[model samples]
Target: MEPIIHGILLAFGLILPLGVQNIFVFTQGVTQSNFIKALPAAITAAICDTLLIVLAILGLSLIVLQFDWLRIILVVAGILFLVYMGKVIWTSPAANNKETVALSMKKQILFALSVSLLNPHALLDTIGVIGTSAVKYSRQDQLLFTYACIVVSWFWFFGLATFGAVLKKVTIPQGVFLLFNKSSAVFIWGTAIYLLIGLWQGAY
Candidate 1:
């Protein structure tokens, strides 16, 4: 129970922040034709998180993060991906949810993968925070902790997407959603810039 509670709290704290990954998932839900159509993003993101959590607990990710050059490569790739994603979102037609061409399943999965695996911050958080925290637990407790985190991640993303889908049903003006897209793009770009700064400062 201690492990479960700790895992839930930690996972929620990490995920509650408004990040590029969350934005993309929510945007997909709002812009897609229906809730079901948007699920690829949520599902893919959940799977990615699950993989990361498992690897982190096993200390596999720690090895990758140990090399300075490898970390640099990851940050560089993440910056480029975030920049490109921001542009894509900024240009998407957000004026009408029904009229907009939602991202295909392929694109959704690809983007979800990029945002999940490419983002250095997320990787570091998983490996640094969760990985270190797991060290204090016994083997059985570690398994419980991992399960708790994975479950929270899956539920949070699905719930977030569902919330966005519900918002689509409201009578909000199209301009509002368009504004949201623009804002989301800008936020994503800001995150890219932040990562670039961190890289420059050797914060990665």
Candidate 2:
């Protein structure tokens, strides 16, 4: 019981941080009024996250745990990917062009799945944190933890998408919106740097 509670808390802790998914959702919300479009993105991400969490629990995480060097490589690659994505978000047009860039449902779904599945940090979150945390529990407890992770993924993506949708109501200046975008970029870059530093330290 205690482990289940702890697992839930830890899952929340892991998922609540600002990351690529959150940034994408928030930007989409601010730039577009189509909340329905955002649903596919969030749902796609949730599916990917759930799949990865299941894979982690089923022993695929061992591949990550066994290869020390792979962590460093993944960390480096993740940082680069974050940095690149941040730049793209920073340069994205404002609400004026929202109609033009508002993706089709199929494209949005594919983009979300590609981004979530390809992200090294997502793998780390599932395999490194969730998988390892579930190892000490019985099979039932492990299942509970896995389900908890799925819940966390669903909650975060849905909550963030909703928040982004609400931001569309604000009558802020375009410049302010651009400033928010830049700030999000900075946040992503900062996280990338932190990850890189951790990888460097661990390598020594």
Candidate 3:
């Protein structure tokens, strides 16, 4: 019981921080008005995270942890990916339109996967935090820990999506939309830089 409590607390602690995922979800809520669209993105991210968790349990992530060069490579790639996303978001038009809606599903899924899989931060969370923490528990406890992590993912995704969809109906100026996009760009790029710094520090 105490393990479960700790697992839940850890999940909340890890996710409550500001990151690309949170920013994207908030922006989606502001623009799409339908939080359901964010569901796919959230689920995709959760699935990727679950996979990492499982891998960590199997000791695969230990291999990753041991390889400094691999971490460096992933961090660099993640930074590049975030930069590209930031550029696209910065250039994107603010108005809600059919074209945007049509592309939303694809874009959301892709972004979720990219953020989950490519981001060094996600790797750190899974490998460093969750994985290391799970070692103290028995196999059953580890399973429970993994489940708690999934619950965290599900709760955050659903909650954010629902919140965002609700906000979609609120009247806002066009400039606000533009500002949101630009702000998201800043967030994405900033996170990427932070990940790069972590990688550099680890490498050296």
- Using lDDT as the measure, which candidate wins? 1
Candidate 1 lDDT tens digits, 65-157:
466576566567656766775686678665443423479999999999999999986896577556645554567888998999899999989
Best TM-score goes to which candidate?
Answer: 1
Clashes of 2: 0
**How does residue 161 of candidate 1 score in lDDT?**
84
Query: Model 3: residues >4 Å from true position, as ranges?
Result: 60-103, 169-204
Error of 1 at 141 (Å): 0.5
Residue-by-residue lDDT tens digits, candidate 2, 1-204: 755564556555555545566566555655556777678878888888889889887783355446656545555665676678567757865433232256667887777877898888778767765565454456677687778778878887888778778866555466754665666566666655655666667631
The predicted structure with the larger TM-score, 1 or 2, is 1
Between which residue pairs do clashes occur in model 3? 29-164
Backbone clashes for every candidate come to 0, 0, 1
* Model 1 clash tally, residue pairs: 0
Looking at candidate 2, what is the lDDT of residue 164? 71
